[model samples]
Target chain A: MRLASKASSPPRRRQSFTEFLGRREVMPFLLLVPVLIFFIIWNTIPTLWLLGLSFYRFSLTSGRPPIFAGFYNFDSILNDSAVWLGLSRTFLFVILAVGIETVLGLLLGLLFWGSQKLPGRRVALTLLFTPMVLTPVASGTFWRLIYDPTFGILGSIFRGLGLPSLNFLGDAHLAFGAVLLVDIWMWTPFMVLMTLAALASVPKAELEAAEIDQLSWWQRLRLVILYHGKFILMLGILLRTIDAFKTMDLIYDMTFGGPGSTTEVIAITLYRRAFEDFTMGWSSALAVILLLISIAFTATFIFVLHSRDRKQASLAEEGA
Target chain B: MTTWRRHLYHLLLWLIALVFFAPVAWIILSSFKTANQILAVPPVWIFRPTLANYVRVLSDPGMVHSFINSIVLSVTSVLIAVAVAFLAAFSFSRFKPPGTNFLMFLLLSIRMLPGSAAILPVYLMYVGFGWKDSYWALILFYAMFSIPFSVWILKGFIDGVSPRFDETGRVNGASWLSIIAKLIFPQVLPGVIAALIFNFIFVWNEFLFDYIIGGPHTTNVPTALSTGLYSGGGVDWTFVSCVTTLYILPPIVIVYVFQRYLLVGMTFGTVRGEV
Candidate 1:
């Protein structure tokens, strides 16, 4: 059948020299070469350089060339308290922020998904997404203002309610929580948007059949919504987790990883090592570790997505 | 659902929207308040709105310079990225070039790496080559970073366009460039616009590269706002609010105008990919 259809398509034209140069196969390569070259120069070379730097000891200001130091940088970083703290804190922040955002976003998505025809939905969506779209530095600045203990709105509200005002970015735990709040505020809309898109795409027949069969709310959710939305939800979580692990801008603007390094994620630590401390080799090792974690994440995500797709394909075949 | 329950749900949705919007609303409000009123203990709720903050921020040559830098950097980078990505995406979609999948995976993995990972080496290279603090440094870097996402989005869009369009153009003796440039490009223009908007916003909001590599000549809005507000002797609430308000306005406007494409673009076309 495929061969018959392929044979029925338009025949190829006579090839002039120019046409041969612009052949369908050749043209794509021509168009893609610039981008590929840019990628190689900007991404590939730098990445390889980073790898090489990770195996050497160097400082930007030392005026000495990098010296080969086989695994020394990695060994020191693995044993460094600050590195461990940053990694653990990053994991904690990702878990808490992404977890809350996902749950809240799912609820909001369910609510708004059912209210597509509601008046003001457009305005509400614009409002909801405003946070996500704002420049992170700007958002961090505004949030810092809002969290100001002296005259910020949150402080005023707390004090008005007969509660003592809490220093949001000054204390260790509160600072972490404050950062989590900022992340959730910025990203929950992402969760909502993704979830709604997934929910909206659920086949109407499947939904009607579930309803006609009188499935309870939980069962309907599990069998229909969850089944259909699981992939997208997982994709959302995966994207958010990876981004959260790289959180630096907001932290940099808000606290500079301080009140003592309480909120320093790996990105900030890496930044400090390279920029402030000028320890190029150690920073490169840290960067390599970060790259490995990100690769592990992408691999896991692709693996899960592939398995789920395969499962679905088989189930569809069985159904047919 | 019961009528009251539905009404309650709508109400809750509105409340959620408002809660999400309150911080931004506060920023906008603060921008209009007096310096003293901005830092008022009870948080001045109602005050006569003033244009003083706008007037002040706009009057600062540094602020104006940063805004121009942001516009130039973001617009150029986004345009370059979109053009490059469109060609690449077209090639991937139509030709299904050998190693295309692997190439795409490599690109996506590059994006997955924390941008900070590349900053150290790139920074050193830039300084060594005398490219640091130059517009090309930022423009090229931003364009490079935007390619993977742009390619993904544009590829998804191109996939939606049937191959028959190309064949039709060919049947009419149209060359490959004309088929892609004239026919395919127009069809995918909306996707291109989405990618453009997305890349523009990403570059505009970029902080790390701008902070580390940008200097007096090339400091974009985000970096300027960070240093301008925080590095000074005291936190001038009014000035900070004013600058931030200006800083966020462009993206806010873009987001509002293109909210329809927000999910697909923001998610790097993953949700659309599912469809």
Candidate 2:
């Protein structure tokens, strides 16, 4: 009598363990393993090493290896006046740059929002985005030339106006403001791009209804434009804020943390600590603090994005 | 809007565009000016344009070497990143292994970390391994840093591909790897190209790591320009302008040609879902 064939043939016996590893179910893990390993080696390990280094007293220039210094590195950084100053200055810079960029970007975005019918909008946009695409280092270099006290264009303009030529990058306050201006110039277009995308998605019917109702400008903004654009606008702000915090290449090229330490932001301070001072352990401590601040910003961004998404989902469900 | 008001609005928009374009135009124009003309008070708008600065910069072997280095580093890093990211993204889009969300979050967080924070340990590690100024060091760092972005973007693109296509391939006895390589990849080729271009532009413009880890042997254009400017006592405005012009050419051209993709790439994930 023919034995009833197993409903599914008994699981095929693998010739070797390697054949089992080649199964379809394991394919994803196999493909992902290499990338995961890379991330662990490059990103995870370095981060942990940085954390470990923070607790040690290691100087590259010193003959001795790293000595475990307990909390000394952390304690010194916490009490250091320079570190505090850098933090505050960075905060101020982020505020000024991101604030101005948001306003300017929104205005431009609104201008071009439904104005696709308008002449030269495409060309105008391309021109506006030119600055955003340029290498930040190159932008910094060009701006440095522009802000040159003697022969720079701004200087010539000042002279033309019968005013004393200002030292744009020389004076302590001016240097900070100058860097802020460059940051705004380079990034405002980014704001405009994101804002424009958001604005494009604004329900045209609502806009027409507001127009028919003769709603005030503020009312139209509140009920039509902003209602739709808030999520993307906030996203743009969050991204810009994080990036503004990471502003080092521009500062490195533009001010080198300044005529003194006037323009020294946290990144610059960290750089000096690690490279200039060769205080490996201390700089690593600063790096850890900087990483914490970045994580905090990123976490807030993700939190806000998720809540917005959920809110949108619930609103859709309510509409349904 | 009234005709006059509309006209005025158009004028204002044009003015804004002009303000943004002025600096870029000035840099390009200055590249053609002599040093005296570059520094001329009441700025020289009309002058006999010269290619002297361009010739001078091109003639410099060191500048040419850095330019080549920038090209090599950026292209190599982008290719490696795209290849690795495509495989991982294919896996993510297809199989979506357990804890994919956690892994992705981890990757993004690392990408978001300040380069300075990561660069410190990386710098030390490089020194310890005697990898300073090595092409592999820069290429590997750039490729690794870019993988998260590439994976995110490429996975989004792959997700857009129809699952039925993969199923059909598998029905025809195509292995997973063969299906991805033959069917899905060709369909997502545009996205792959976009990712490649984005990574290229990013690595090309990168400065901090190039500044710290890179030295004379491996100096890229940005590092070279910055260092030259920082160290040179008397600034040669014309020469600097020429170098800046040359430095920005490739990115500007790429952005102009691939404006749509470049815009999405530059904005990360913010504009993609909305538009």
**Candidate 1 residue lDDT tens string, A262-290:** 99988888888899999999999999888
Question: Each candidate's TM vs. the true structure?
Answer: 0.94, 0.94
In model 2, pairs of residues that clash are none
Report the Cα lDDT for candidate 1. 0.86
List residue ranges in candidate 2 displaced over 4 A. A1-24, A118-120, A315-320, B1-7, B230-232, B273-275
Model 2 lDDT, full chain set: 0.84
Report, to 2 decimal places, the DockQ of model 2.
0.62
Model 1, position A161: C-alpha lDDT score: 97
The residue pairs found clashing in candidate 1 are none
TM-score of 2: 0.94
For residues B1-275, could you state the per-residue lDDT of candidate 2 as single tens digits? 88898888887887887788789989999999999998887789999999999999999999999999999999998898888888899888888898886776676677676678769988887887888899888888889988887887888789889999988987787777788889999998867877888888889999889988887888999888877873557777787889989988887788667777855586554356422
Tell me the tens digit of each residue's lDDT in model 2 across A29-148. 988876887787778877788889999999999978999999999999999999999999999999999999999998887886656555876677677778877888888888987999
For each model, chain A TM-score?
Answer: 0.90, 0.92
The per-model DockQ list reads 0.63, 0.62
